[model samples]
Target: MSVVEVREDGPVSIISINRPDRRNAINQQVALDLQSAFAAFDASGQRVAVLTGAGEDAFSAGADFTDLPELWRCIPTVGITTDKPIIAAVTGWCIGGALVAVMACDLCVASESAKFSYPEARLGFTGGMIAGLAARIPHKVAMEVMLLGATLDARRAYEVGLVNRVVANGRQVEEAVAMARELAESAPLVLGTIKRFVTESIMPKGPSELMGRATRELGAVRESEDGREGMRAAREKRKPVYKGR
Candidate 1:
């Protein structure tokens, strides 16, 4: 089966992350598939796209750590521009780079069991992963998520405006589809125009550029003592020891 599945339901196109065993983690292929799905949705008669994960367990666990540096650098919609409207239907464990995808969506719906976090700080890099957090949610909430690496449940995510709706567990996909259908009922061109107008004016630049700049300026950080130490600790399944490095 394909790692990413795209199906059309009349005017709504549903693009699902189909890696349940890995909690729908984004890898190089997944990233490419997601981009292709979105592009198809944009080019088709479909008026809206609903993004979700397969199974009832997870929306996405984030990027596969094993695919870091190279593959992890290419995230779907992170820095690219699109005129289409995509809605996120989150179920569970929407953490790390997965949250970045969620932030990229125009609207988001989460199941009660859904949880979110940004652990890239622990991995020792900042810009490429979460450049959209502050723009999507409050600065304080963004800071807490990125710095403290704490998990935010569905209710809290909704309260902080990180999610548009919070449904009961297992109902996220249903609710998201309903919302997509509703959005599809509108004039497609007008909706697209509005989406572009608002996003271009308010949304920050593409995350790819920001991350590219970050990777260049922080090249030393990747080779720093703390960077190597953090990787070692993670490999050994222990807390990382950071000694001013």
Candidate 2:
């Protein structure tokens, strides 16, 4: 069976880590499949993607210990970038590379039963992407999570802004799909433009440069047919139909 399964759910594509027998751990095949799935989703013109694990017991227990070296190399270098947003639907436990995957996503919706940690230190392994940890959580919290190597519950994750929403166990995927569907129904170009703007705003650039880029992007959007439709739809009190212009 495939280590990862990709399925279409309307405008949202679901990419599931399917190695539940191993707690959905990341291995060589899993990494390749996931990379392929993401690429396919981007090329398929899907509006959004929901990434999850197959079983209720874990989102991913991290890298398969037996293939740690391969995973270490593959995790960082391989993965596709998609213009469409990706939502991580985390359930059960997340650790190591699993946490990395979720952090890479645009949004994260986690189940209340979910737990997170990076125990690499305890195992004499170095952590991946220290800068990412610092960027995602408060300084002290990020330090504590990494240095202490303690698992945190989903509620704590939400409080730290690492997770967007936390729902009851088994509801993470459902909640994420609902959010994705809402996004998919909206103007795709607007969403892509906003994502680009946010990304540019965070880059190391002067205010003038950032503002210039934002102004140009906005001007382009404002001149598009979708922009006119958005206004017309507001006037008509109905949803806008955007053709991705």
Candidate 3:
């Protein structure tokens, strides 16, 4: 099975990071898989996506230190860009880098047992993307989490606007999927328009977020069929025919 799994239920695409043994921590492979998964979701007929961790001991225990996954690559707006809405189904522990993804999601449903903390400052390093949390929630609260490494339980996260709602332990995903189903039935074009306007116009983008977006765009072009065709044409001394994919 894939490190990250993607399945469809009508217009909703559910993507799960499947490393429960590691508390669903994101490793290098998992990051790449997640990046690819959302890219596919963006190109798919799915109107909404629910991002969750498989087997729910944790949404993720942050990055897997053994491989140090490129944490940015799996973050919602940062690594994966879609005009479609994406909801986070957070379960159990959401630590360190995991907060970045949860914060960036358009809507978040957290399990009551969930606990979110960002200890990167104490851990002596950070991806720095979490800085955007201040823009999403109150500045002081974001600062508290970042500077003091404070933890937020699901209820507190909702009160502070970090999460949209909180539900019982195993019902987080179910709740998120219910939300997704509602979104799925809405007008896709209108939803996409509003989401894009907020993401590109209303929300502020920090340096790391900007860089992540640029990197994601670049990576897309580099991995596209046209990029390969261009290289082949250059080697063959002929003009490349671009597919504009």
Candidate 4:
């Protein structure tokens, strides 16, 4: 069986880590499968996606140690980006590379049972390319998570803005799916445009360049029919039905 399972639920595509026996530890195959699943979701033009682990015990314990060298060799393949919005449903024990995976998503919804850590120090390694965490969390908190190798509970993560929401145990995926469904109901072009704008403007780049890109890209979405539909729906007090146009 595949270590990762991709399932589509209407406009929300779910990518699940299925190796519960290893606490959903990522291996080379899992990385490839995850990349494939995200690519598929992007190609399908899905408005949103949910990434979660198969079992309740762990979202992921990080990369399979046995496959460390292989994983290191395939790091580029493991990091895939998509235009669609992704929501991470963190259940438990999110650590090391698993933490990076969750951070890569647009939003995160975690269970109360969830615990996040960067144990690279303990393992004689360092967290790699964690741009999102630095952007999302306060500097002090980010430093602590990195330096102490201590686990932060879901509530603490939410407080630090690392997690958007925290639900009861076993409810993470359901809540994340609901959130994804809500996002999917919006104008796709507008959503995608706004995501790009914010990501460029606020994260990882200078404001001037991001502003230019935002201004150039915003016009396309603004001129779309879905934009009009959004306005009309607002006036009508009904949900907008966007055809991704």
Off by over 4 Å in 2: 69-78, 200-245
| Per-residue lDDT over 1-245 for candidate 4, one digit per residue giving the tens place of the 0 to 100 score | 98889888888888898999999998888877776677677788677989899999999988888875233221221245465788899998998888877765789999999999888877787535443466668987887888887689999999989899999999998999999999988889888887777665656632433343354357558878999999999999999999999
Assess every candidate by TM-score.
Answer: 0.80, 0.78, 0.94, 0.78
- By lDDT, the candidates rank as 3, 1, 2, 4
Evaluate model 2: give its lDDT: 0.78
TM-score of 2: 0.78
RMSD of each: 12.6, 13.2, 1.6, 12.9
- The C-alpha lDDT values of all candidates are 0.79, 0.78, 0.91, 0.78
- Which regions in candidate 1 have their CA more than 4 angstroms from the true location? 69-80, 206-245
* lDDT against true structure, model 4: 0.78
Highest lDDT against the true fold, candidate:
3
Cα error, residue 104 of model 2, in Å, equals 1.4
Better of 1 and 2 by TM-score: 1
Query: Residue 2's C-alpha lDDT in candidate 4?
Result: 86
Tens digit of per-residue lDDT, candidate 2, span 51-98: 999999999998887865334222211234556788999999998878
**Runs in model 3 with CA error above 4 Å?**
236-245
User: What digit string (tens of lDDT, one per residue) describes model 1 on residues 1-245?
Assistant: 89999888888888898999989888878876776677666677778888899997788888777654232233434433457688899988987877877887889999999999888878787545575678778989988998889789999999999899999888988899999999988888898888888766777765564665365447558878998999999999999999866
Tell me the deviation in Å of residue 185 in model 3.
Answer: 1.9
- Candidate 1: give the clashing pairs: none
